[model samples]
Target: MTGLIKKYIVYTAVLIGLLVFLHAIGALRPAEQYLSRGLNPLLATIYSWGTNINVAFDEQTGKADLWQQINDLQAETNQLISKNAELKAVEEENAILREYLNFFNDHSYEHILSRVISRGDITNVIGRTESILIDKGSTDGLRIGLAVVDEQGIVVGKVAAVKEASSLVRLVNNQQCKLAAGILGSEATNGITEGELGLTIKMNFIFQEVEIKKDDIVITSGLEETIPRGLVIGKVSDVNKENNELWQSAHLIPLMNTNNLLIVSIIKP
Candidate 1:
């Protein structure tokens, strides 16, 4: 035990002597500076790592926020599109109502305004014939034989059948709805205007000697009890006369296209 203690005291004594010699020569201060320089890079590396981590976290947060903003903008755009479509539909309805009102103000006859709801029969042969369903009905004083006119007071059709809320109009171009018409000219030849095939009107039974020509206006003769006088039916387009036959006929072109009609007035009187 004494020998081991003597060896430990000798080691401690040597370490003390070495530290004293280094201090006397100023070696401790230079060594401290060297140690500080070597440790500086390690400390700087730790700080750089911390800064990069913070920047990465911020970038992740910014990306998430940007995506959220894009989703919000898209939702707002869809809402605006829906609202614009609604506004456009309202504008169109208002324009149609305005046109009906203007027509009522200009005409002197007693009439009921009605909208065209359907065309042709269940067979869907609208192009071949002139039959349309109107919104007005028996409740609105519409009945069979009531004359229907367009916005410009031109004769379109007559109410052929009526229901409580709707009615069927047999247009002037229909084979069943014939009009007693007179040509507006010096001779004013009178004839029966009948609907021919393909939406054409033929004014038949006119005297061959009558001075009927193309572009002559044909109007209702008012000989029928239900129809009024002077309602423009159509204009003459072609005249067909046979030297052997005593009667002549003329093809009439209607002022309004029956298929394209939107609104009409039912002549109440």
Candidate 2:
């Protein structure tokens, strides 16, 4: 134990002497400015390692903060996209409702609300007819010869056949469907518009001497009880004059997009 004490005391004295010598030479003074110049490379290497450690720690903290901000922004963007989708859906529903209201206001006669069920014919009634099916029938006050219409009262077709809970709508595009149509602004021009395919119609039986132009609005003339007056049929798309025949052939663009039908009204009386 005496020898061990002696060894530790000698080691302590040596460390104090080395520190005193370094201080006398100013090696420990102006530490920041002179450390590199006076410090032994081995000791300087340890100091440089400590400084590098601190710099790396700061850089890691900054990177973490940036990543956190990016995550926050991504979350906000997702929320906005979801909200926009919901708003669009509501807007579409409102537009559809408004169109139906306009039709009811203009015609005060008789009306029945119906929803489109399926397209094409289920029973295949008249082979010459283009038809769609509705979810309302005899149960909903629907009957044959009643006019089917879109939300805007645009002439769709007449209910030609029916079951207990469903009915068939003969589209305006049916080969057998015909309507007496008049040019919106014309007093003397009148013709019969008949359906073709792809929801298009042909305004036939108009004399070559009749004046018609593109984009002219065509409406039902109420000449028959099948369709009401002032219901939109289509717009004049093209006109072909034939010298051989007494009537001119004209193409019509149907007011309704047949494939996209979702809601329709029935003219009861």
Top-scoring candidate (lDDT): 1
* Candidate 1 lDDT, 95-163, residue by residue in tens: 676977753322256889976666666353443547877776666787888889876667888788876
- Candidate 1 — which residues are off by over 4 angstroms? 1-107, 122-129, 185-189
Per-candidate Cα lDDT values, in order, are 0.71, 0.67
Model 1 lDDT at residue 2: 98
Scored by Cα lDDT, where does model 2 land? 0.67
Best by TM-score: 1
Model 2 stretches astray by more than 4 angstroms: 1-106, 121-129, 187-189
Clashing pairs in 1: none
